[model samples]
Target: MGDNEAPARRVVADYARPNAANARSSITRPAIGVNRLQIPPQIITMVTNTIQFHGLPSEDPNVHLSRFSAICDTFQEQGVTEDACKLRLFPFSLADRAHAWLESLPAGSITTWAGMKEKFLDKYFPPSKIARLRSMIQEFRQKPHVGGDAEAEPGDNEAASRDPGSADTVTDSVHDQRGGTTSGEPVAILGA
Candidate 1:
């Protein structure tokens, strides 16, 4: 072959080779009992438009999966299972880092929605983050409001701030309906 023809033949040979990327799939699409499982294009568009998980720290994987499952539930075909629809459409909702993470999973590893959800949550909202949130919840305590409405609960500053005499500053005992006083100390009823 001539020099120019050799380069053209090489290009054709490269094109003829099987694409390794297409040989393996991260998600195993379930066999829908029906012969034809037709998913409307509009439905796919709705999912892509409604929610996308980009793997951001602020993005909650639980919320993302919840929304995704809700959307998947809407797609009810006669013979196709909800899981089948989710398997096909879930990929359309992932973008940026989230899409990359899904693509990186081993071929045929995620066979079900539950498996995908577990992997996604474990990767994003790990045990360390869950423990920290639980700890914060256990430690949370409402601080005393220290001022405002006489009828307000000791620590309910949100309710007291709405009153006209919200500037009032006094002891928690004075705010109580039961005529209890603390150390008999004089309190400012309005304007600190």
Candidate 2:
């Protein structure tokens, strides 16, 4: 049988066969020092929105991490089991670009919620990458055009027309290194 195939039929067959009294006792016995605790299943009654890749862009790992933490908190608050949490988080990627990477992993590679989270952080927000992004954000500067009006700054307009990617040009949409919309206003990176 393939490694991925379930052993349900074999388990059923074993259970269906009649066993001798000694064999039954041996099969039903629990090992010493092993605790067989049964936890009650929790019913998720609240309707919570699922996290989607669209909401988390690849350039914003810090924001993605924050959002992921919130989702995990919500899952815990709703009484989702650890295993269930791992399964639930599989569909939710921290970034749109990461979705394919996550899908490419072998089935059941991430067996626990903690393991999945660790893998995600290691892949997307490595220490060196995070530091580089932070440096870029810190060095970012916006050069506002003189006179505040486009009509008043024909020279600046002409310069912008000549070099679209010039450092002196101010963009209408100023995205920080973490990809958060600053709206030209400076914003502190979360968890920085």
What lDDT is obtained when candidate 2 is compared to the true structure? 0.50
Q: Best lDDT goes to which candidate?
A: 1
Superposed on all Cα atoms, model 1 deviates from the true structure by an RMSD in Å of 7.9
- Taking the tens digit of each residue's C-alpha lDDT, what string does model 2 give over 69-116? 654455342433545543454454433556666756665576565666
- Give all TM-scores, in the order shown: 0.67, 0.37
Clashes of 1: 0
Segments in model 1 whose C-alpha atoms lie over 4 Å from true places: 1-23, 144-192
Clashing pairs in 1: none
Q: What is the Cα-based lDDT of residue 150 in candidate 1?
A: 56
**In candidate 1, what are the lDDT values of residues 1-192, reduced to their tens digit?**
776664433566787799977677799999999998888888889888989889999999999989988877776899887778888899999999999999999999999988888899999999999999999999999875455455655555533345555534334525553366456665544432
